[model samples]
Target: MNTKTPAGTEQITVSNITIDIVRKDIKNIHLAVYPPMGRVRIAAPFLVKDDAIRLFAISKLSWIRRQQRQFAGQERLPPREYKERESHYYQGKRYLLHIVEAEGWPKVILKNKTWIELYVRPGTTLEKRHALMTRWYRTQLKKQIPALIEKWEQIMDVQVNGWQVRQMKTRWGSCNPDQKKIRLNLELVKKPASCLEYIIVHEMVHLLERHHNEVFLAYMDRFLPHWRQLKAELNKLPVRHEEWGY
Candidate 1:
């Protein structure tokens, strides 16, 4: 499809990687690798030339390629059938799902760290079963948020107005520092608890600095010294399967 270009944005391929360059009136060049498919982007000063941008990308060629490779190799959980013997995750631990049909309320319980027993009434529909499991995950994840937020708010000396969990396609967490609110991705309920806390701390730091610039990272370093490691671990976890819309 043909589309009109934004006033100063252009697309070019460099070092076998497609780079989207947006020219802005800025003091410095910024390069980023975004997720889902690891799209590379460069924000450059309005006067910068394509050749200079190519050279910059070339300098970071190895790093860019490595990031792309990691994205390409990221694993995904097959669509859930909500059937017996399927694998599921909680707190980064894998468990086989065991569906148990019974007479009472629907629930999910981890039995002996090896299996997740999902108790439901007979003849539940697929969507209802999925909702039951999703609700259980949300309940478990919510239980930990209050303590984590409280701990960080005191340590960071920041007040959070509110927080919630929801399905997000591309972000694990986001902060609205203006409103002092945080939103954590529900998918995070499947990752390690440490990873969850790491995201919380990262978002809370936005209260101090909004941009992911040097100041923001410095704050992260001060509060969570091992934040880089935690980020790596979180990224290493399998990403959720998303329905791509082109």
Candidate 2:
């Protein structure tokens, strides 16, 4: 798409090599580096100058490359099929999945020898398997979130109004300080329970500090020392597939 710039019409490149700039209803320029490969995105204001954008990108090239390398080196597990010998993660421990077809409702069982039993209907599609796993995940998280919130509230001395869970596409969690509420992504339940606690603590800290600045880092370090490691693990995990909108 050709964008109208003050200096006539200057073309901007968007490809695998460099960044893609998009304009949206956002307060500030937000940069993101995606996984599986180093894909950079820059969301700038529509009225921002092209030269200024290029200069900002060039100045941050080193930091951007470092972020890309960090994302590139992150470990990612292969997608799982709810079949025998398949692996599933719970509380940071890996277990082989054992598929069992029972007469009634489906359930997950942790058998001995590092195994998980997935009881589902016959001929279940990948989406169905994911749905079943997600449901189980929410169940697991619901058991843990309350305790974590109670713990963090004591430590941070912050009381949240409420919290909820869902399959979020782009965000790990979000907070509305005005409402004193937090929203955590349901996918986190598939990860280690520590990961869910980390997200909860992180978002809860947002009630104290809004942005990911020094204050936020200090809060995380004080509240959860291993937050960076947990964040890395969380990002490396497979994200839900998204349907793009115009």
Candidate 3:
């Protein structure tokens, strides 16, 4: 029996692990464990039976627990107050923030590779400061992405239509294979360039294979042999602190 809610989502409990199921027009079942907390979700075809979904979840139980444990052990940075002397990250290096009050427009600059100088007018609120820093991160990430995309396009034989950087709570990046466009998390600016390149390659591979099946893994292995290491490195880094919403 399937217990479904009004929102068209169902929950199945197997081995005390609850899995959220959403029926979609997709061809195959897609299981995912989301971050911040290990929320297990499955996107199954609308015609699939409840028992089959339950059995599939059962088979992947060990993988699900491993992912949950990883999220539990993952480091999370404390909430940012956007104040002076606060530690910030750029290109995987820690830098202390130096707030400068001035009459001119707000701007961000790196000084001596040890400090992130934030220039803002007096009485700037925390929200404004955060917005300014986010903009700067977006700008810096955008500047580096196109070149990486171009580099991978030739190696992988795929052309990306467009890409954008946005703040995402649960995902580092996503791809729309149909549109040939990808959206990367703005928080990636805090990680190393290699991690950024890994994500770009990962998304581009989606253009070749829409699913995370054997074909996709084969493409990843062929294009970036050390991608798994880069992925592990990215996952081990400190994630930004944010209030999660369902």
Which lDDT values do the candidates have, in the order given? 0.84, 0.74, 0.87
Clashing pairs in 3: none
Which residues of candidate 2, in runs, are more than 4 Å off?
A: 1-32, 41-53, 69-80, 121-129, 237-246
Who is ahead in lDDT, 2 or 3?
3
CA shift at 148, candidate 1, in angstroms?
A: 0.8
lDDT assessment of candidate 1: 0.84
CA RMSD for every model? Answer: 3.5, 5.5, 3.2
Candidate 2 lDDT tens digits, 124-186: 777887778777878887888898899999999999999999767667789998898999887
Local accuracy of candidate 1 as per-residue lDDT tens digits, 1-246: 112257654777775678878776565778877654778878788798778888888898888888878877877777899999999989998899999999998888889688999998999999999999999999999999999999999999999999999878778899999999999999889989999999999999999988766678789999999998988777767766772110
For candidate 1, the C-alpha RMSD (Å) to the true structure equals 3.5
Residue range 1-246, candidate 3, lDDT tens digits: 677767867898889888889877677888887665778888898899988999999999999999889888888889899998999999999999999999998999988789999999999999999999989998999999999999999998889999988888767889999999999988889999999999999999999998776678789999999998997788777776762211
Task: Tell how far residue 196 is off in model 1, in angstroms.
Answer: 0.6
Global CA lDDT computed for model 3: 0.87
Q: Which 10-residue window of candidate 2 scores lowest in summed lDDT?
A: 237-246
- TM-score per candidate, in order? 0.87, 0.72, 0.83
* Best prediction by TM-score: 1
Of candidates 3 and 1, the better by TM-score: 1
Where is model 3 more than 4 Å wrong at Cα?
21-32, 42-63, 243-246
TM-score of 3: 0.83
